[model samples]
Target chain A: MDNNKLQAKDFITIGIFTALLFVVEFACGILGFIHPYIVASYVIMIPIVGSVPMMLFYTKIEKFGMLSIMSVLLAIIMFVTGMGYLGAPLIIGAGVIADLIAKSGGYKSFKKTVLSHGVFCLWICANYFPVIVTADSYRKNLVDGGYSTEYCDNLFRAINSKTIAVLLILCFVFGVIGAFIGKAVVKKHFEKAGIV
Target chain B: MALKLDPRTKLFMIFIVSAVVMMSATTPLLWAVRITMTMIPIFLLIAEKHYAAALRFIVLYSAALLISFKFLSENSKGFLSAFLVGYCSIIVQFMPAVITAWYVVRTTKIGEFVSAMQKMHVPDGITISLAVVMRFFPTIKEEYSSIRDAMKMRGIMFGGGNVTDVVEYRMIPLLFSCVNIGDELSAAAVTRGLGGKVKRTSVQELKMGGADYMLILMFTAALVFFVVFKYMK
Candidate 1:
């Protein structure tokens, strides 16, 4: 709990939380593979599932830089797994700002945690940025490789249609939703765990 | 040969190569480099005597490429094929990182990794958090299996399972126990003198050597060549 020292348990809490985030992500991946039709569902579930562990993490660490450390670690993992290097910067930046907001509420403000989580959720969409930006090149690669014109155009258009702004707003709405749900779950079930 | 390189260098190179693969518009030369970069992992896995895993990577990568090619060339249109194509491309793009991660994780010892981070002057927050990342997953795996067993005994099958049933019965309890684990682990770490004010030392030898420098130089040259080719062409 001490910001200055950050005993081993604090780091342990951060580590487990990071792994939990990844586990939820892995669960989401399994769902996507099984129900490819529900890829869109992932956009919502990604934040909510991730935030479940994160809300508990925030509740326990209750200090500065814990979220930042966890975010950086998760970002590194995401990058290493080929999600995108873009996630690294986006996560670290969003994490720091989120940490600041949480700090403003003295790390106990549930409202601040919710707002911070909403901001933090934006980074999860970093995986899409490369697809959106390179949609044209991907189209070109397909077309030049003897793909049909319609298929190429349709694929490119599909990716291009979802601009960055649209993605962020979606994350914001869902992030708030996810955070509130996590808060309720934590309060109800994890109460005896003492995090709440 | 890359096995001799420092853990820090492997991590740095992976990040650099992954970013390049993600960002490029795919000129001919870049494609050549991407193919070669993808193969490095396979070779390293082979060197590490992981023959089965290495063969598996080759088969998967080839399969993905074939699938993408087929989808791209298809005249009939639907979101399903398009989605498959998109996903295939993503898999191919991320393959190098995935392979490299596999190699690093399989080859590097935990003590060596911690020492490597210490040598890099990484903050305790990050280093200790990473140590935790290292320990957490295997623990989770054990706990996960037991939870599944418990669910089976209780007749808690999913598919027809209710959402609240999962949230109430499965996730909450799993999270609750994980929290307890975290507390015990942290206490164990503290008693072992982790998070001390003074500098900590480890028995792991993690210094950069000649191979590390050579690999760094080689990657740096390749990067320079890519940049020059990108602009000059």
Candidate 2:
């Protein structure tokens, strides 16, 4: 029972990695302003860029709940940053599913880890929820809120309901690819340093 | 005077501001309410003696507001105008929540935050992880700067012109340091009796005061005013 329980150490690890992941997200998010297509590409950008810290995190995870807690944190942060609560369910859902997948692999199997990561990366799609679910109103809000019509048109073009399915698949595929790259990086650095 | 507020009140302020921020203000009156809501946090920052930050936020926000209102419109075309509009609108749209979040994070100590969370019956896992997250941002910034300095000394500018190198050079070092720091942080936490079986006690007792009540009332009023004016109208 004690072995299964999360400790202070686990919490700190989750906190550190969550912070790192957020930094990566914020950095990539800044570029979306340059072009709407960049916004749609967050799936590719975040998973690959964020995977290094995540893979390192995976190496440290010998228990469950870490990823789930991290997702809950991400949801709260997204809300606090004014991303709205629309995506909160998807974010938390992806986290729990990712946690279960990793657990099923006993947190050691490489195939399970990659698949778990792919599932976890779906949270990136949650950012598109407002755009898809409230398309008309959200577009109206943007135009009313000072965004250019061109920008809105492009945004909706790149990320409407139909394109979202493709984006989710891209996010998962890139997540799997990112996992392998992240594992290599971890092996190249952390494993050599005896930190893993 | 250093007007200390209860963490709960500050959190409520965050909640209200974020909620208001999510919904765009359409009418002038709604905008007025929104601007005023944003100002309260700036004033609170000033009251907290964060003079530099308050002044900086005021300048940036008002400048963005001026540029967006005076210069840009929906019909404004071209890349430069679009770029300016994008930047200005982003600042105008999200700055309020950002400022409020910054104020809350800057003012609230970790112990106070944790105790308040416990008082609210938050799970220990979430609370502890959240507290660490709150404490780790500044540390990351500090570590990042040091890494940048080291890179400069080696003359490894912008990952030697490779995009992957740009990411790899910075990210790998950052990850290593963060992992090490996490270990050290957990050790310190364990030494302090964190995750112990006994129910923990706090050194700083939390109590809501007049300021807390006043701020809560004001924020609630602002939220109510925003919603009613935006939707009911």
Candidate 3:
């Protein structure tokens, strides 16, 4: 078997980690309904929470395209769950770039993995794309879609076009931070257990 | 007869419903179209003998619609009302896509899904990975519940009040089991010739029957009606 080509095992690993990551995202998503600020804080919540599985995934990454495939799956899931396709480009873009970053490190260097995971985490901000891109129409749609005026106000206040830049930065920074935490936890638990 | 729709048709239904879901229904006519689109999946669920789920979804969706229409409005105030409105509105807005997706996931077998995707010429990586993902949600839920049960037995409630610990206690164990399961799964799949260089054949043969075409036509009509009405003023 050629070591360069991803096999059935690699795809299964990607699938498992993607499912785990989506579970984390769904859990954090339910919390966002309580407050729009919590919605804004998905940057902090998902990356930190989701990084555990992802770090484990990174350890299994011997070849390329795994991260990218995971991102495509994430985009498909986001659409199916009614999150819209406005974010597909950003999600896949981040995934491929993250893949390349990790590849440059031979998928082993800690610094590149951290940066790759950070780049990968930028996909979380894709949730806010519709809000930022079509500000007026989206607000109107929210109101028309039965969200109360106050909810729309708060949601918009917390996540408008201007705030998206900041949100993106926070997503990346916390992604870097979460990668370290994820790596440490993986080390503490999986490496000791020989799973890693 | 049991209404066994093609997986391709199911995928089309998901595509249409999600597109409609992205755009809000402004007028009563559009809302009617949207509601009809939503009901088709529930009806399919019922047809598939998922009566309990169908009933639950219907009751919850109707209740949310009634509350949103009668009590909550654009100007509903206060935190409790806001919370209520938020939940109800979310239900009203995303219920169709959720119901369709749920129906698809619950009713379709993994073999059929993979064969359908194969027929459509999707990449093997995405297809296999997505099939695993679709097949794994229930396993994850089962694993999570068992973990919760074990945690409860140990009196580790709420991770002793530390939020990170709460996350760590649950997540680490879940990951451990999932990785182990993935290993087992890949072994099983490879034994079944999953990654062979030759194209794999399936026991499940996919064909678009009458029901598939009919449902596809209905969904396409609904999507076109929605976009034209909502956008082309």
Query: In model 1, what lDDT does residue A178 have?
Result: 89
TM-score per candidate, chains pooled: 0.86, 0.97, 0.97
As for candidate 3, its interface RMSD to one decimal place is: 2.0
lDDT of 1 by residue, A102-193 (tens): 88998888899899888878777665666565677656666665455655564445445454576678787898888998888788777865
Q: What is residue A48's positional error in candidate 2, in angstroms? A: 0.5
User: In model 3, which runs have C-alpha deviations exceeding 4 angstroms?
Assistant: A142-148, B72-74
Q: Tell me how large the interface RMSD of candidate 1 is.
A: 3.0
Tens digit of per-residue lDDT, candidate 3, span A1-196: 6888989999999999999999999999999878888999999999999989999999999899999999999999999999899999999999999999999999999999999999999999999886788789877766765556777889899999889999999999999999999999999999999988
Docking quality category of candidate 1 according to DockQ thresholds: medium
The C-alpha stretches of model 1 lying farther than 4 A from their native spots are A1-5, A29-41, A142-162, A193-196, B1-5, B24-29, B70-83, B167-169, B209-211, B225-231
Per-candidate iRMS values, in order, are 3.0, 1.9, 2.0
Expressed as tens digits, the lDDT of each residue in B1-233 for candidate 1 is 43665788877777767665665535667767776777876887898789999999999887887787566555535656655666676677677777887777777777778888899899888888887887777788888789989988988877657776775576776787788888888888889788887899998777788867876786677677777786687
Consecutive 10-residue window with the lowest summed lDDT within model 2 chain A: A141-150
True contacts kept of each: 0.65, 0.71, 0.75
Per-residue lDDT of model 2, residues B1-233, tens digit only? 67999999999998999888878777779889989999999999999999999999999999998888765544657777777877787789899999999999999999999999999999999999989988999999999999999999999887368788989998889988888899899999999999999889999799999989998999898888888887886
lDDT string for model 3 (B1-233, tens) is 58889999999999999989988777889989999999999999999999999999999999988877765444667778778877787888899999999999999999999999999999999999999999999999999999999999989887388999999999999999999999999999999999999998999988889999999999999998989998898
